[model samples]
Target: MKNYIFCLLAIVLFSCSPKEQVQTFMTYNLRYNNPNDGENRWEVRKENVADLILNYQPDVFGTQEGLNDQITWLDSVLTNYSYIGVGRDDGKQKGEYCAIFYKTAKYNVIKQSTFWLSKTPEEISVGWDAALERICTYFLLENKETKQRFYVFNAHFDHVGNIARLNSSKLIFSKITEHNPENYPCVLMGDLNLLPETDPILYLSMQMDDSKGLAGESVSGAEGTFNGFKHDKTVTDRIDYIFISKGDAKVKEYKVIDDQVEERYPSDHLPVLVEMEL
Candidate 1:
């Protein structure tokens, strides 16, 4: 009788413990829709992009350079996912968006918000010397089964302004630290457009643990993200990244997805994918 009671208690305790959560994150710069892109137009590469996402099925993903129609198309195809973000120009669909998508079946969005990367973060305004308006979108999600919570921040830094990028990094750090005080397992992903040694990158590294740097195994794949629609150009610089809040998650795998079909690539910037445990 005592043995039976002990066994039952052990089973109950095991069931009550929080389940280990493993999630995958992907960051891709869709490369703004432009008629000048010619063969690399959205219509030409969308299916391939969709197929790639469906095949890997990341638990969450952040996208940069996505215009309204482009985001809508992705919304239509990714039936199991829901996204949060606003246009950077007017905060109402007037310009490109940095969108974050998550699997709806696995998690619920408890809260979500967006802010411009400028001095006046509250309004739709450009920051110091930024060439264009930049924005960051964030999602606070709760796992349905485990009830665990986490945050995800998606962004695109200015490509033309050095001061803007530096200040933008500081702004992002401040925002993240303010909102994520509990240190909930959080992930930041985006097309940073800066080299690894840049001030912005270095500052962010101090706040978060990069998946590529923390992966238990060596990162396997291409070293760069931008391809510039040049099939033969060797990609050697990485400007995209997925970073998790320090002490919040464990990096299991990191990959730079550079797959192509028939010499047709999905986007100018390859996707950065990471698997982590919380």
Candidate 2:
């Protein structure tokens, strides 16, 4: 009787204890336009996106071009973490939304806010003459130890609006580097829409180091991240990226996930994940 009670107590304690937290991050641009897409819609590829993130096991995730349904769906599926940051697409309540997901067990949230990527920046509305409006999600995350904390900014710039893209890039740079808040580490991830050698990309490098793939590797994973669907197969370009601030933290590894899952492709653009350590 004594041994039986002891064994039961041990099991209870083990079950109640906290699980280990992982240290990693992932970013993806899940394309919008589900309602109009008809047959090839977001619903067809949503589950695969969630599964891809789960496989990499990033402590945080930044996503671009997520609609209301997709965001809600992600929130529903991802119970272990919390997500915030609204999309400033068409109006206050329409168009694509960008967001960040943080692991609850891994980090404590200190502060979180959203900023617009438009001339009329106060409101979450689309920029005039821009292909699409952009909003950046910023999070101040702290470890359980209380001493470790850092900032993460995620955004999606205009696809066709060149002026908007340059303007948005300037805004991002100012937010991250202007104040220089005393050794605060930061990780910036998103679908910038610009390629490796573009003007905006170069400007970003001034503030942080762009995380690239291995030396010998020409590209990270599959060719282009923007797959029209699993069937459309001409992958090209390296637009999506994950970069760490040059001063504070070190970017250990960067990869573009191009796994051939059976259900469908993960997102319109392949997810770019970076593992960093401070």
Candidate 3:
């Protein structure tokens, strides 16, 4: 029976198409420490992240909960990748920042932009959120060899504002799908802060495919992500996520790696990775 099960697993694994061109991607919330630090530090949590990035080496990475300094630290360590220019924290580029990193050797830079999630979220501005200002940064990229133009938008929704999160989810759909209805593929990833059943996530899923959670593994249930700092094994919520474009793209392999090694657990929230094909 054991031999039979092993044979079954091998057959299943080999049956899947080996799309060599499929890209490996990661999304994380780098944990900019705003609550415990007095010196305005985003690098307080740097060491933990640096180690993880070196291990994953994702072709494209989208990050939320990153400040300018944190981004700088990452930029310094990962020499092969370039960011989407200088990104903004919200509609206005301000105190906080979110960004997309691409492995220059793996893909070519095509286009990039950052937008806010407020009534007036400029690329640079410290707006008043119920808790904090939120922003979404996007990059339109192409494989140097395949020449496929796909988009990646990374964002952080307001932690305290339900209405804002709901509205911002709507904005993403409009700017991405409604505006480019002629088949512009997009990948949306971020620390959305809402569960699958919540209004915000539900609204966004209407336009984009939720690559990490809602499609295959648990088409109807939540896959826990945000594991607390002390009791690392206890998981109760699904906040962080990875999403793919509306057309042609489908998540092939998806996983949430949860293990305590050198303080890297895919980022306070498990770093979700997905392989998608065109």
Best by TM-score: 1
* Per-residue error (Å), model 3, residue 169: 0.4
Candidate 1 clashing pairs, residues 3+ apart or interchain: none
- TM-scores of the candidates are 0.93, 0.82, 0.80
Q: Tens digits of per-residue lDDT for model 1 on 171-257?
A: 988998899878788888999989899999999999888888899675878889888877777787899999888887778889998
Clashes of each: 0, 2, 17
lDDT of each: 0.90, 0.74, 0.70
TM-score of 1: 0.93
Give the candidate order by descending lDDT.
Answer: 1, 2, 3
Q: Write the per-residue lDDT of candidate 3 for residues 1-278, one digit (tens) a residue.
A: 99999999999987874553578777877766566543223444466566777776788887776667677778898998888634453233345566788998877766677766766654444334446656787877878776777777888887887778888888777677644555667788888888889998887777667786433753322257776453336676888888776665766777665655554343566677777675
Can you write out model 2's per-residue Cα lDDT over 12-131, one digit (the tens) per residue? 987875433225778888887567775557776677777877777788888888877788798898888788777565444466777889888778888877788887676766665576
lDDT of 3: 0.70
- Record all residue pairs in model 2 with backbone atoms less than 3 Å apart, i.e. clashing: 224-235, 224-236
Candidate 3, residue 111: lDDT:
65
Off by over 4 Å in 1: 1-20
Give the higher-TM-score candidate: 1 or 3: 1
